[model samples]
Target: MNINDHNPLPTYHAADNRYQEMKYRRTGKSGLMLPEISLGLWHNFGHNADFTLGRKIIRRAFDLGISHFDLANNYGPPYGSAEENFGRIFKKDLLPYRDELIISSKAGWDMWPGPYGNWGSKKYLIASCDQSLKRMGLDYVDIFYHHRPDPETPLEETMGALDQLVRQGKALYVGISQYSAEETARAYSILKEMGTPLLIHQPRYSMLDRWVEGGLLDVLEEKGIGSIAFSPLEQGLLTNKYLKGIPEDSRAAKDGRYLKPDQISGDKIQMIKKLNDIAISRGQTLAQMAIAWLLKDQRITSVLVGVSRPEQLDDNVASIKNSQFSDSEITEIKTIIGA
Candidate 1:
């Protein structure tokens, strides 16, 4: 029997109408459907965070119709702690509803010290998926991704491992994140020829950062691979929190690891305040506008959002309610963004 079997916890029956409000979009041409707003375990579900709070946030996300939970091998401050903690909760709270969830993990960044630990290689990819499954206490993940491209490793070998995982019953689908448009095309061709089509691509996209717009979106569209926008708020740059100045507890201030204080330049702050005004005019927060803006592009499968609190989930998910943009509204937004 599982060690957690004896531990008592609050009952977490999902909301009956959880699927009613939220819309599901097909990932690429595949049958897999993901919620419009998927929750990411990149920030709050780490080791140093409170376990109870993590559980609460997860439960709230589920209650709000978020069935997809994204994770990575190097997500935690201490590494693997998010998955370790989530595994405990899964065994306890979400075990019975396992079929209702879509869990994904990646392994491209530096997950360990050794040279073999990081990057995409046949051995490293396979081993990292196993480790991730073990940490999440799952038999298989819905989608296992190559976190990033490895210029060192041959694409054929990396794609082969992903294909092998699908055939090995370790992963239901495979994806790539942070690959360039050309690289994504090459991967898609290789994977398709190998008889294991790439399902989706995750890219860093927001009003502040629009690199994906150049050709990435078109590539995904032509290739029939879905795209999920990560950091859609640009590490909170597109939000009102940084309007006046960075708060002491803001991600830029506290988590200098990825978001830095210097990154918040004066020009960006002026742009954020302008975006905030538009958000207010639309009766939504700047964060919501940023999210809604991403969703406006039909090619985007979903906007992967990271929330520190349950209320933030409520706000982000609400963006879907008014995601439509008028001709002039789009023009105005693009003008302000200098697009």
Candidate 2:
């Protein structure tokens, strides 16, 4: 059945067939299994966005078997707005299914003013987690991540804080994001000695970016820690959005913070066009192909996706349908992306 077929209802009753189409992958050695396509609140679920539209998109996602919802403390434009918004939606539509969902949040990066409000210090990570729980109206988050590594703070201290959170019951499991191979290994070692094995790692990976491939994936394999890739679309560059020059409303045109106008060079556009051809031959959109490419590696536990609307989820989730690739297609993709 089409999960997105219905209109607004006074109450939200999730589809009984929600788990039929979507696939679930075991998260490393953990008992937890995450959806192949998880929803992220990194964009368009903030104070700047329409509340009703965001709610509709989230409900639609759950209907399609997306049980994981990813968020960060500073996700919204105003910082914490996304969690506040998710709190409202949880109370209204998803509270009943809370046990069936895998909800995660992160800390690190500049969140509030002053030194205590940022970084990987036990103070900041602990305080930020408390604030996030209050904002999201939850007793604990399923997974709490140290969003990025801190140079000043010792790795032991940071991982200790995560261990403390798990022990204290503020977070069921702990993970890290954006750490290098050396750092991931170090963090894993520290957490292992502390008896709170690092559950997963979140990294920015895509056809356009392959930094994680240098050494991180190998480390994850050796250590038996799972990985979830963010930015699998590379800020929408891998999609058909920029095939005919940047639109006025495109992310590159408006959000200069991440996807800049200068980054989309003439050569880049040509490469995207070539990739689009490959996707067409495979009967999938470029976005779908990009996501499917990442999942081809069994080391990648899941691919985190963000969408401005619910309809976008329909296409992204379908990536699992045709994840297989011929050797020739793989070689062609490698030659095109220069990876």
Candidate 3:
């Protein structure tokens, strides 16, 4: 378990009981079964963060049955730095467990400042896949997602690139993130025709945000497309950290990139406190309850939870201990979230 400072060949072997606690769910109709809770590298895996800490989170998560590690080409402060750091960690710790892992990378947002650096064009996607593979030091990722739908790029061309990747052995499964029900249907049809079944859909789902409940989740269920809910805590809004008010070190105080202080207004704070009370009644932290709420739905294949520290990861993983909710609790939660 100790790292040889001289050679550093990554002698880390995950715990034998890694798969004992968490249950794996089948992705849509595919044979792949992801852990109930997956780890996403959207934060704290960048260059600004300590590489050692990031590596520790990955190792501990693996030991806790988090076999899926989600990443993207544009996921770091300096763009592809997260993938590069993950590649380094792969060499230092996870290379041996590669087969046991389900790693995914996305490309659809603006990566570079040029024209071809963004969107769903085949050119950009193909090149970005190659770059991501190089940065992650992997031969093929389990899933490669078109980060978002492009209004301009033809769906055929965009999905065709993913088809090519699968055929070329660069990516095993293809998915779409943030695609609406209509767009997802079209994309799925095209990929299906191209011989690559759309594996899953990544969407932001939580108590605070119920957009997925409108029609997207239904689309996924009807089409047998698996779903992994991201931001299930609503960027920390659903956690106890903002129940009283935003902390000085919260993501809102320092960085307003995605979360803003104003979003945690008086009304929102009150709601969060009420939700926390409900969570406490369930014998769980608000964070754990938030995740458990998502897992209550069998259609939701997994929940992508991101953490900065190993303790945070431990808390998130404990959510699986109580993933069920009574019908009365669900009704109360819906009323509380203003549904």
**Of the pair 1 and 2, which is ahead by lDDT?**
2
State, as a TM-score between 0 and 1, how close model 1 is to the true structure: 0.96
Q: Candidate 2, residues 163-266: lDDT per residue as tens digits?
A: 99999999999999999999999999999999998999999999999999999999999999999999999999999998887899777887678777666888
- Per-residue CA lDDT of model 3 for 38-145, tens digit only, reads 999998888778777887889899999999999999998679988988998988899988899999999999998889999999999999999999999999999999
In model 1, which runs have C-alpha deviations exceeding 4 angstroms?
A: 1-9
lDDT value, candidate 1, whole model: 0.89
Candidate 3: which pairs clash?
none
What is the per-residue lDDT of model 1 for residues 57-136, given as tens digits with 9 covering 90 to 100?
88888888899999999887678888887898787689988999999999999988887899999989999999999999
- Of the candidates numbered 2 and 3, which has the greater lDDT value? 2
Ten residues in sequence with the least summed lDDT for candidate 2: 1-10
- The positional error of residue 30 in candidate 3, measured at the CA in angstroms, is 0.7
If both were scored by TM-score, which would come out higher, candidate 1 or candidate 2?
2
- Sort order, lDDT high to low: 2, 3, 1
